[model samples]
Target chain A: MTQLSIDQIQAGDELPTLSVDVTPTTVVLGALASRDWRPMHHDKDFAVNRNGTRDIFLNTPNQAAWFERYVTDWTGATGRLGKMQFRMRDSVFPGDTMVIRGKVTNVSTDDSGCAWADLDLAMTVNDKITTSCKARVAVPSGSGDNPWKRRGSDWQPNGPGNSNAKANGS
Target chain B: MIEIPNEVGDWIGQPRYEEDTEFDVERGYIHTTCSSVENGNPLFWDDKVANELTDGPIAPPTMLSVWFRPHHWAPGRKKQAQPLQIHFDLKEKLGLPEAIMTDNTMTFGEPVRPGDRLKTRQILRSVSEPKTTKLGQGRFWEIEVEYTNQRGEMVGIESYTGFGYRRGA
Candidate 1:
């Protein structure tokens, strides 16, 4: 997979849309993989009768995996996640088509020299947003620069002007 | 609006529980997780591709919490500890029947690879006053969970916020 360098990205860049036809198996497997044994995510009767949802729905970590996959698929293997925050506005039940779309909000290098991209992303079902996400990812500043290799003080996820602090109001 | 008792509010800033995962991060588990999402990222499946990035194939960063999820049944254990105990505690303390997560933020530190064992610490961060929403009358609360590898290296932090309410209240 070809990795995108910082130079190749700019604010306002839109990522290719990703769409998935969610099914009962999709929901159950996601919950199973995450080790989430919550009945609402797997047991349809428990979900509809007890939880009062239309059907078994995707759990939080399941949705999180989806968002991470959507971003990394675009950034390629070299891309490393620094921070990801998302708000769930509604449930994504089986039979719904979840479409993910993203836009680059900003791209900048921190004082530590870690190049970063801030993205605004959303997962929509049938044109209605189920979750909205903001992500901070590290991309190569130039050829051969690997963000994953950075550690200790070099990687500051909550550094100044970083979206994490702003999102948490800290 | 339902009143959040002072005792419930006091949970804020208190570290709830710290527990180690039941098993080590396994390559097969990673494969199943990737398959569940239909994620084709080579880093998760291809050892060569992963070795280029880290020591070996790494678990997806989003799977940070999956490691600590309490098993449904253990041979000797009569009752399992509920996952996210603080959330359930709040629900019971406040007497809310329904709960839903509103938002979540995760920050990654180290790459979680096969054989790495993880531990997590949950802390209550904040709680909001009861308010009315379309769903019902509820309050919002935030909890932060810190994940660390067996080597004591930081893995990630998950800041989760949820709402607990009485249906149609």
Candidate 2:
């Protein structure tokens, strides 16, 4: 995978969308792989009687992992996950399609000259957002060096140089 | 109207778990997670591609929760605490037995590599004042899980927010 250079990226640049069929297997496998063996994620009866959901649903950790994958897949090999935060609006149930889409909300270089992409992502189903997220990823400046190899990186979610600092309101 | 409990504040600023966690991060498990999510990124499983980045394949940041899962079923294994005990506790107090996640946030440090043994400590950072929303009557709480490697290096930190509420009064 090619690293996106500073010039190759810009605010509002929409990343390719990913659509996943949220099947019972999809929901259950995601839960088990994450070691989240919660009954709500696997047992339909428990989910219906105990949780009051339509069917066994995906767990929170499973959703968080998917958000990480969505962003990193866009950042390429030279990039590192900076920070990821999101709000869960609705439950992701089996048979729902989890369509993930993201855009470059901001781009900046930290003190060390590492390129960072601030992404705003929404995982939606049935025309409603199930989760909304903001993430930061340090990408290659296309300067031929890995950003993670820098002696130090000041890539905090709301650090001084981060363009989203004020927006993060931290 | 929602009534906030007094003990909810007692948990704030307190360590949630009794002990820390230490275990070797496994590659096979990493692969299982990647495949489960249909994440085919070579960064997670391809050492050849990883050599281009670091020493070897690294676990996906999404696998953060997988490391702490209790054994599926073991005769003598300590019963793991409820995933969201505080939320459940508060819900039971407010007559709201169902709780859901309002959001999740996490910050990663260096990449976690296969074979790297790591430890983690869980802390209850804060709990919100009782509030009423369209969903139900309850509160929101944040839990922070910090990870440290066998080398005593910080691996990553996960901050989670859970909203516990009953559907209606």
Among the numbered candidates, top lDDT falls to 1
Write candidate 1's Cα lDDT for A1-170 as tens digits. Answer: 76998999999999999999999999999999999998999999999977778999999999999999999998998888889899999899999999999999999998878898999999999899999999989988897789888777677776565534222212
Poorest lDDT segment (10 consecutive residues) of candidate 2 chain A: A161-170
Q: What does DockQ come to for candidate 2? A: 0.48
Q: Evaluate candidate 2 and give its CAPRI docking class based on DockQ.
A: acceptable
Per-residue C-alpha lDDT of model 2 across residues A3-79, encoded as one tens digit per residue: 66677889999988989889999888888887777789999999998777789987877787787778767777666
Off by over 4 Å in 1: A161-170
Per-residue lDDT of candidate 1, residues B105-141 (tens digit): 9998888889998888899999887778887888899
Native RMSD of candidate 2 (Å): 3.7
